[model samples]
Target: MKSVKGHLRNRLVKARKKSAGQANIWLFYSFKLDADVPIIGDLEMLYWVSELETQPQVRRFTMEHEVEISLEELGDSFEEITVTRVEHIDGSIEFHQVASKQHDSFEKVSVPVRYKIENRIEKSHLVVIPAARLKAFSKSSLSFWLKVIAFVSQVRGYDLRYEMGQVGTSISICGDGTIETLLESLSITDPALAVGAVCRSVLQGNIIVDGLRSFGRNTRWRTP
Candidate 1:
């Protein structure tokens, strides 16, 4: 009976190998985010936390490599996050994040956030850039930024310089005006509005106001 059982097991293993072709395969899964919510860099951390909630029962696994997901924001809201796992011969696994799908969503209107940079040293201009875009920029070299000159010219006075240590491209006001000067000249009382306006100018390549205000605050060279 034992000899028969061993023969059957051997046959089953051989069958599996022949039919499957490969001895083992990497595992992967699809992850999706709700369409109504905005896609933010920090949201990835939320997903990581949610996965942790399934601990113990799910069994903890050691990751062989760090995960990275693409951060290209679509005009519409349907965004898909893909997680990939690679199995290695040494019993190690690698995980990666991928942005694979997108669709339109009418439930939510994306808005620029007024984020305060704690201990911000550069007093010239407030830099606001999507974290994912910043990561892409970091991976690139100086050649990647050459085209930015024409796009930045649309903003008027600011020069787009690449900072190797920084997360995103920053326009350090070539002129003298600071945030306070900008608010005063534009007759803008609210700081949030000012931040939004500045953020829009940096992102959209142009500001809505007319004359000097039309070019936005970046062009304003203050009186020393």
Candidate 2:
């Protein structure tokens, strides 16, 4: 009986290897905001906290080498944040909050809110990337470049920069404006060309229609 079991296990493993072939690699990009960023309106806050998922897929590719190649090409132009907690509430005026601490900061604070979709809003612009994407780019140089572009796209509302290294990618979000200012900055001088460019870029990344941002570790929160 033991011998038969061992044989079956071996056969199963071989079958899986044959059928599964290679894993489809993907990167999960996420952004975590401070719950108090004020720019996020009620509707946008709800969607960000309640409706939107914490994880966003910035890009995907089959070959690990290709991913590394992309990251290298981009280099020092992406960002990453880990969110500790997020919440939403319904009342006369709906609101949401997110609390977190980044490596660069000594303490956590509530970020101003900004209107997103509907009455929902985002306390802060948070983005996440999945483990799959990491594996794809594990041995490539281009992974860093790809990450930079994806990070920039995700936090279009912020003044952000990407830092690249052989070790990994880093993103920095700058806070230097009000919600109105942020929105104004995003105003496309050429809407048609801007829209076309965004569409094309998104397609290149193979991002899903319902792609959402994922929160990260070290997140903390309070509800009222």
Candidate 3:
């Protein structure tokens, strides 16, 4: 497999060529827990780093793995991981990775995506939250949001699908109204941000992410 840096650099070069003459490039991304395929425990933290590219108006986002310990070596220190076959197709991102050399367990996670034009030009923000908190928030908030979307879609006669991505998660609805319409009518923030408050609370040391295994378990979410 190619190094993460090499793969990213190659993609970036091609992206630059496509969006030539664009003086500034803004990248917006986030770190999210993959609840569909939950990680082991509090001792290990695994997440995906998703990048949103602008100027080229690409629909697909590039994603890579971010873990608390190196997959090659198990330790508390952070390290880079090499993922195989990173590619964007249609409205989804697909990639595969082996968590660690010792584990040697290959896993693939894919999810549908919708690029927001507004986020592209904005500065990237780093979310400071513990891995446990992230897992808790992702599990709970995703479950609630998915349920809400499902219920709403059923009543409104629309088609709804829950998609988990490397770094983000979304509830896609198609029918009488679009996601934007639902958001506007419901006055709820983006489903991706449903856990923002909870995550921030964890970062502020006000909450601990324990006993959060119930979120998203009830629904039949698509897995990579």
Candidate 4:
């Protein structure tokens, strides 16, 4: 039984790596001022260093990962930009912009991501999906995963909740459910599905509950 468990563990790890290889992870950052800002007509530039591994032996793999943004054309009098943001729609995006009396510089900001396995029996990997995509998905097809998470949580004797906030997205699942069981329950075998499930599970119940409450409040307000 111990050996069998070990074999299963190895297989799970391999599967996770394979899935990750096919994963399309994205990062988006936005900077909004309380008021509009001035533009000098010069293009704004942004760049970031990423820690993605590149394997030379793999023809599909590249050794370097970097992101850059350039905004060259701008109106001189067009001061007061409401918001300034950069989105890494696909792949990774990172950068920093700063202003000061002495000097202005762009620094590298690190966005950390964590992935882990839960429940040895079920083999579920807890992954943190990007927030931009969460917002996009929440606009469509979010309820499906909510039901899946709720059902899976109930079946596996776990409390599964998706918490979406202004800052980012997160998922909480606690009980005797294993990672494998959680993944299986979601019926996710591909990278897209895996990431989608993570994002869905994270954004599910809270937004729905909040919307329902808001609706009820509005209805009550209108009630004579």
lDDT per residue, candidate 1, 38-78, as tens digits?
Answer: 22233232222222211112223322222222122223221
For model 3 the TM-score comes to 0.19
Candidate 4 structure lDDT: 0.25
Candidate 4 lDDT, 1-224, residue by residue in tens: 55523322232211111122433443322111112222221111111111111111111211121212212132221111111122232433222221211222223222321221142111111111233333433454344433433332332321222211210222133222332433444433353344334323333222222212212112111100
Which candidate would rank higher by TM-score, 1 or 3?
Answer: 1
The alpha-carbon root-mean-square deviation between model 1 and the true structure, to one decimal in Å, is: 22.0
* Highest TM-score scorer: 1
Each prediction's TM-score against the native?
0.20, 0.17, 0.19, 0.16
Cα lDDT of model 2 by residue, 150-216, tens digit = 4434544542221111001110132232222322334345433333333223233322222222211
| Distance from true location, Cα of 31 in model 4, Å | 35
Model 1: per-residue Cα lDDT at residue 79:
19
Which of the two candidates, 2 or 4, achieves a greater lDDT against the reference? 2
Error of 3 at 107 (Å): 25
What tens-digit string does per-residue lDDT give for candidate 3 at 140-168? 54444333323322322211222112112
Which of candidates 2 and 3 is the stronger one according to lDDT? 3
State the TM-score for model 1.
Answer: 0.20
